[model samples]
Target: MNIRLHAGTLLFAVASFLMPTVLHADVFSPTMSYSYADGVALSPDVSYQFNEGIGLSPVVSYQYYEWPGDGVLQLSSSPRVSYLFYSYLGPTPALPTAFSTTSLPPTNMVARPRVPSGTQFLVYTSGAFASGVPLDTNKMTIVLTHGWMSSSDAWPKDMANVLTSQGFGATANIVAWDWRVNANLSAGLEISAARTPSEGEALGGELLYLLGANYNKPIHFMGHSLGTMVNCRAADFIHGDAKNSPGKIPGSTLKLNPQNTHMTMFDEAGAVGVANALSLVTYMLFLPTSGDTGDLINNFWTKVIPDHSAWIDNYISEVGRLHHEAANVLLWRRFAVPVISDISSGLHAYSYDWYSNTVAAPLISAIGHRFSFERNTLSPLPPSGTYFLQSADLIDSPFVVTPLDAATANSLSSGRALVYPTLQAYNGLNVAGNAYLNGLNAAGNVYLDGIQHAGDFLYDVTEWVLSDFNGQSAYVGTGTAGSTPAYMIPAGSAPLQFFWDLPFTLQKSTASPLALNGANGPIIHPADAGPDITNNTAVYVWLPVIVPSNTVGMSFEFKIVGAGTNEYMTMGVSNENYFTMESKFLDDGVWMSSGVIEISKYAGKQTQLFFSMNGDSGLPDGKLSVRGIQFLTVAPPTLNISVNGNQAVLSWPVITTGWQLEQTDALSSSNQWTDVTNAPGVLDYENTVTNVLNSGARFYRLKK
Candidate 1:
């Protein structure tokens, strides 16, 4: 076969395998131009011919084109020859010491200042890395692998910068992997699915050659989606009997440690398989995409970490309704194709941007508790566990997910979980031909949506399991076989939650709740002498307040659950507290929201926040749990303003509920603010209210 290399177009970042999207134009079909065959709308020049000579084999002639439609690749009757002949994992373009983290802003802390190199600075960039740079054996090496149709310029480049910023670059060598030809999004998802081994071999072959030249260094391989499988194959090749290189690193000699990759923080993964995965629409929209190679991994690849790396840290999002970011139409069609099922995306959900943001700012929880990943580097293996986390609301939650131990993972088998016949991992000494859970990969059962043939052996080339469950397939009871009843369907369960996020956070005061509650997180006492004293019916105490100098949308916010008529909480700065805000916080704790208190009112001029309550000390309905709490920073709630005709409209997201609109004639430290009487109503996923345009300067906000 002949090949031609052309000057390719630069790429950008997306949640998954992304095709070109007409962001600023209409999506119209070019009628007389072409039509879709199966899922691909092929180029007019792409022609096929069968050889009249010898065996009369079919031949294809084609060149890459900038097509406007979707479906670049397709699933073939037979799998393509898997190799690095075309696909490869290459290095990044020569980077100036500086990187961009505009998409993911890092928190600047005095105690731990962010340098030019840190994981928080990760973002996508275009172009290729310069060649001929020698590997520095003495430095720490990090290899970022991309999934499916994505190029190195996307997540790999972005994440590399993030790692560099977190002090890893001071003594590190970073590289991003590129495998565009194999998994071209325009071609189709199957193309990417079939390319891992070939690219993995390519990466392994390159690393073997580079390391064999006496270039000894500690290497960390990080891949997202299909890239994870690429890493496994690469690791296997490096450790395998390759002609030139026998054992370099990330092989039998090294243990892999990864955080925020495909793995979630949940350790009881095998407990229910993908049956109990997160059903949150927010995560389903992004983290779980076509490139998430998790569904494709057989029993053999799952053991890669145990045999090769140190430890793996899976930080994934769990069950929730509220979306942190709005959904984009760009996710329709091509981007929506799942490798397994609609549930597959939710199973191993995580985003490259989310991973890079871990080392950035921290968030505050309801009742005023702070939560942040708060780490510097990825070296010195992180603790292993599946930790479920939440950070979408105004306030954040203070909970962590844990992973199961390695020793237990290999031997444990649940009736609810589909496992190998040996009751252990496939990579164990027990031999096997095929061991899928009979009906585990069936049409309607396994793949519930998207690519119906994704895991079926009939169409998808890599599908190794038989088509039928157990009833009458020529194959054995792989998915539906065994000593007991057919594990026909999943015993599904609901997602677990231990979080409560309000809208804002600060860095003032420390959490010193009463003795009975606990010593760790911020806690308020039922009968507090701390921030809320029980001396009389009138009680008040101070909390933290900070407005970042650089970013906008800064606000002082919190939520009190039970504050009712019996106990009302009052918020004020230095000399002013509004009657309107007190009323919002007085609805028997059922109705409460102070929205956003204008931060520009008092900047370096020293502004303080004190909460006062009018009522008895021991009222169970009062918000006494957050009495002596301090603060931190997460993204505060947002109130969008737009002009429609002569009217100015105010709106906030549906995720952030109970935020009351308030109008202040002058946003000042001594200004008296009043509530916007016309109650706002939900429309098109936003709480919207129309107000007549004011000729004078008037400020409005939504506080919870």
Candidate 2:
């Protein structure tokens, strides 16, 4: 999951820039609104159109609310539309006229450059509300949803600060959705505020009308916490409008349903009627922690509440029933078989007592701040066959009774750590080493053991044993019986990088045979984690950094700040024996150096790059801060050579690459290729070369 943590305090800065020229006249459009109360509602009927792909108007508005402090809330939800832009289209030349199409200037935006691959996340920003520079929404749209307790003015400035610092220039729009005070004070309030039928309908109508009046373009939406509900309401309105309009063209704003709302289902569940009421009535009632209200409810009902209520719990059950009913004539058994197995495998002990104490209590105290839950003497009974079983001999026991430390304890508590199962027996075959092994959190920086394969292999990447989890007993049989041992894996896997470029250099060496490599250059020997720099400055490295693909890049962007007029430093990357790359600085340090070099060339198959920084000499003691590091792609490999042998021979370079080769018959191209011989990290292949000789000539090529 892509989750943006809470940014610090909100800070605002305002500035103006020259407007861009007309690229897509449909980009700048007006929003539609209607009056309900006064002789003239807050906003007048000011119809606007996108002329020359630009709409510039001075927004002057004034409004008042009587309920909370009767203070005035000023807000604006502007629109910026434009034509499609493709990276391949090349650079857009700067126009000389005031209507130049130069990209907007960078604003205050901060972002953690490294994010786990495959995790869908969003960046949020709140600060002094101001108009955003007009740019292409396709590249990025800063969905400025305000917090309920505070106005958009209270949003953390760091998010926008970091993003602007990066290259996302002119790609953000400040959207201010003025919500009622206290709307998001808690999950319950957020839910109640969004579910208010009439109010929700009105908000939806306003947004839909605005999109229609503006450009006819689709938009990407993002909501934070309670903002998720508002976004959902907006989506509901758009769906309703689409249903009502039929053939009519809706606004250019494409309605995003659950896609835009990244709230935690656990939070939503906590906001549910039962959860909410219980929480409100009792200050001590615990509830599951969640990222946002929406997600809390969604995940809770789907993953946790199976037997809680008939209609509520039956949501997924209905899906099963539908499949079963249709299976009579459809042969749905093929799909249903797996579904049933999955559901059965998911059979978990349901107990309100466990949830209240374990999941809910801690989560509420941790994430919900001041909220409390009501206590009840009537505890929820555990499901049948789910009673907690105490171990007569904790040493020989396989299961951990405690839920929290079960996985961890099971591995450590075992007297004989090596006596557990191997990974193969659990899955029936080796599953490790395959690049296609997904759904594993490895894509998100979650490290599993890296697999080494000489043949067809399937297993998990692990170092720790399942026996470690015996501490709590919950993970007794989770590991492979004999083949897949109950070994517990370490916190995260290695390729562990320790970086330093300050007072001294980092000394690194495997205390227990840890593998290490380098890039750019290495200035020190291998040792454990310790300070190498003598000068007062901090070093940096990618924590738990591992490669997603064979080819990747690592670097640090550093800038000198403070009293030193000129800063002197040296930085490099190196492996156990050789230093690959290096850089030296002796002048006033104010510029950022970003260069890309090949890690595959040096590291070969799988190697770890240790980045080191040295503050050999500098004016004042200043530290080096690494801003970014990422991956790049290489050209596809070619099917260069092949030999017709008994097993069909194939040969290719032994390099770190993501390319592969496949072959087909020239005559019977429709038939699938047979057996083949291969090499690790090689791009070339010859499938059944010996067998293909009988069929005359064969065709082959490399694939990316």
Candidate 3:
């Protein structure tokens, strides 16, 4: 049931560094073309020989270079990511321990410090880039950033050796961003994470120096643990390159993706025009050694990841109590990206070693089938799927390839254990052509069914909801019987972050509740609607936002910017991340409100505010805008009065939060209101209080 986003109608299951948004942007993942020169595509050096066998070079021979460290490049201006970098790493001098986007430098290159540190760049040349020498722009470039408490000798070098040995060394320039100074702390995990952005941004500057602003060669970014976010920030800081090449990340060098509602689905919720939205790298692969820090950081970077790269993949290895987890970057986008349980591997701290083994021989073994880039996607571009790997630790290479079907005894695809959104949202659970929930979005189904997921658990040390989706259960929060509730699917549940700062523009809407359901009916809904007449077959992509307390309604706008003939599109809003709850849809009008939304039913709940576009036409690359989201306090329950002979009975619908039944004389400023002495009794969802009539002119009112 999980179908993450990418170019066209969905944003990839990307990492947004600040917070995880349920947005799947449409991306154009292009195949890469490398530029190679000379016969030296044989060996990046003798180092990678044991890892991979393929080599790149015109001469088909191996050449080794004395890639020296701590050298200055001839580039003008210094790295602008930081004011000054220490000889090693620690809390950046002037930056805050918490994330603040404004605190970041603006230039594609931040102002470089006068002096640099051991945290320098390592290029793939015999000698470092001294004054005037640049990298071979013709060759493809790959950069590796390591995680906290790590250095170049660990997985970064292992990664470097494998990539080169995998036969790509000829047209490849592998660079290692050795940043042990800032990250060399065993007990300072939090401190190192705070330094991620600046460190990553600094790497962006170094990349510009190595590749130049307009370097057109293909680029790949690899990071482990905290390094994943570092790589994302670097890509965010890259500019001119993204703008120049359609095949390359435009938002990366050209510019970041336009102001996007990051956590929403595919295209316009209301419908906004998006020309070229790609992720940060040709391929941005994330690998975390253990903890949930990777999930939180990656969640924060989803904003940057979706707009910069053509393809994105996260190799998750569950090392309980070891390091970090690149868990849900692609999962909650309704993309069935699995949170591979390394515990499934029955090993500890061996995820790094095993994954490095995959990079060296990706498609040759059981585990390789999981980590291999050679996946089968319907699209012709580089394959994209959360590696569905299951096995015990590796020996030399990928050993065991156990698919989901083996464990569950179900004949599902690699990760198709439970379907999300459900076959229900696709009109019915058991569609005719669907091989279970395999391809729920064929013309037969028109939407993604759920797939295998680890369910919902708060994992990251920072406390981000592992899936960034918030809600208690797939079932609606009320007792009303649902005739066709598709209770059988992989469910993505609630949002109660564990610890990381909630750094967002948080404001609760004070508007009145609408009556789509009840003023207080549960808001969990599987949002989808059809215009019976025209049959607009458009793929609707919804953005998941946290509707603050009292948010009763929202205003949005959508337009069919460009589409094939007879293509029609509509927008919808929902309270669930995957839009599987009851929802509001706007089929007409340029500017309007999804008039049926109600939030009072589930107070104290963290639910999604989604904008989705669905139609029956060709892929409508439309523009959608959601604005004026307003929250309303629950209106006082209706106060009713009935005279039973001598006594007067007063009643109102029961309020979950205690309320007072007060009586006042006259409705003026000077009127004194007092609580009724008599206690009320509840009957049939209403509270009733009886009292004798008084002679004075008295008025009744309700108060907290």
Candidate 4:
């Protein structure tokens, strides 16, 4: 059984428990008082008598009498005499056995006890339950219980006071279950602890009555310390009784089941299995007291705390180390850290202070704990889930979901893979047979030995960076010669991002007729003549281009290292739909230059420049290799000319330093152009010159 503590403790200074001033009153009192109301009608004294007992008994008789009177009456004895009266005969039954009183008999009064004494629920109306305040059962009901050595007048009463004085006063029925007798720690811990279950049973009966009376009302139970155990036992007992005798309480849907019940336990104590039977909608544990020796061992101190000797020393300290540590763990896990600590008392009493003053008061005073309550209100109480409560320093504190651990993260990145059984066979071989196959070739292609059918397997020669190749039949590469072909180039190899997809293998061969710069280059040949088979496959390489808005044209260079008969290559800038400076089929091995292609039309657009090569039917040994790919862009001219009266000043940045100025005149097809005769001079990285605009409507341009 998991014991979850539900209530959080505040950092308030722990107040010493004030010994309750025991009140003495008649266990069974029958008295009469009368008041005369003017204009009230009065009838003759009418009386009704009934025998009250399990069986028809004349020993006990209850007589109820009433005299109705109306009209203005004087303050006289005669007027007071005409009033209603009730009388009971026979020995009065003993007060509820659950009540704490020295006058009552010590023997048990009933086999199945009902209500406990001093358990009257107080109603609050807008934070006050002064005289004449009516109770509205239509509102939500919240029952609070005090722990061992504590009376309802202590924390229970304080909780009620907080609820009423804070926001819940107008919206909820705050009931302080005064099972002080059962919780009397003065009698000794064991003796008082033994009666907690019975006290809980009695409380459960009273709750059943309330539920029956106020149908479908939301009810919540909050207990601190041992009181938490009492609530758990009570819920379990009530649910068991309900299940055994289904019709015991008529018209009540609340069966003490988890769905209908909600419980909050604060620093729980007592037996472990108290709340195991209860299926609550929500169970919360608020642990404030810590450093208790027992708690450290229970929470596995050896695992979390480093240095076993220190842990032992801390555990045996006068101050509870385990208890406090446990509290810190709980608070931290819930992302409610930096909580104020109260070390005034060694015992667990801070839960009450925190809950009543901090948790509950804030909900009432300033609609806080919005997520904990329903509809952002305290009236409905919280729905079910395990809530770990804490006194947050701020309403919106940052919560850490998962903490980073380098060691654990590293282990995950290097964990070994486990093999599972499967029926599929690879290379026409079972797992047992394929396990022995080894040795990958220079192209990072794995070939199975002793396989009669060569075409049964397909090879995907994509370059890989990692070396741990296990489940995959294809070889993983290290991107080096005599290994796998290199797919990625060093950063900044070329300005425009380029990606290659030409089917080829990296081979170290100095026997090539063409002079290749690198020690090795990609080579492709007819499928039948090579290790892999191929049909009429096309080789294509492209680079994505972000043509600047000010681009004028583009230039690039390419070389065909080697090509056999019927193999040709074409290079150009293609937007998929169109191409610029598309070269004709070049079958001969030669370096080709793409004399500047006008690309201003494609400026400020996303485009790709592609090189495609096709191998047609020819010699079976036909092969082709491409290299020396490069691209460059020409920028648009940036020239400015200002005119003042008859003279104009022409200037341009050094980027256009090699440009010449030209002027054209005439609006017709017949236009004449001339270069400016004035020499230019450089100033502030700008080429400047003065020109005389004597002609009207002359057009000027910078020619590169």
Candidate order (lDDT): 4, 3, 1, 2
Off by over 4 Å in 2: 1-542, 550-556, 560-586, 601-609, 615-622, 634-694, 697-704
Q: Which tens-of-lDDT digit does each residue in 1-704 have in candidate 3?
A: 23321111111122211211121112111221221122233233233331122234332222111111212101112222111111111111111112111121122111111122424677544323222335687776677666555677666666666666666556677777777765653213333443454566567666666667667655666665556656766665664222123224533443333221011111100111010000111011111111211221222322224344545444332111111111111111111121111111112123454556656656554433132222222133223332333332334323454433343322221221112121111211111110011011122121122211111101001111122222211112111221111111112222111112111110111122211223432222221221122222223322233333322222221222233323332322332221111111122223323222223333334333333233223223332323223232333356889889877889875422346889987888787899998988744335679988877766777775
Task: State the C-alpha lDDT per candidate.
Answer: 0.32, 0.25, 0.33, 0.34
Cα RMSD for candidate 3? 29.6
TM-score of each: 0.31, 0.22, 0.32, 0.29
Ranking by TM-score: 3, 1, 4, 2
Candidate 1: misplaced stretches above 4 Å?
1-128, 213-216, 241-306, 317-350, 360-387, 391-394, 397-474, 477-704
Q: List, in order, the clash count of every candidate structure.
A: 61, 111, 124, 30
Residues 422-523 of candidate 1 have per-residue lDDT tens digits of 111111111111111111122202111221100000111010111112212111111111111111111111111111111111111224333211242222
> What range of 10 consecutive residues in model 4 has the weakest lDDT sum?
277-286
Per-residue lDDT of model 2, residues 355-428, tens digit only: 22322233322211011111111123221111122122335322223221344323222221110021111111
Which model is ahead, 2 or 4, in terms of lDDT? 4
Query: What lDDT is reached at residue 491 by model 3?
Result: 21
For model 3, state the Cα shift of residue 658 in Å.
45
- Residue 461 of candidate 1: its Cα lDDT? 9
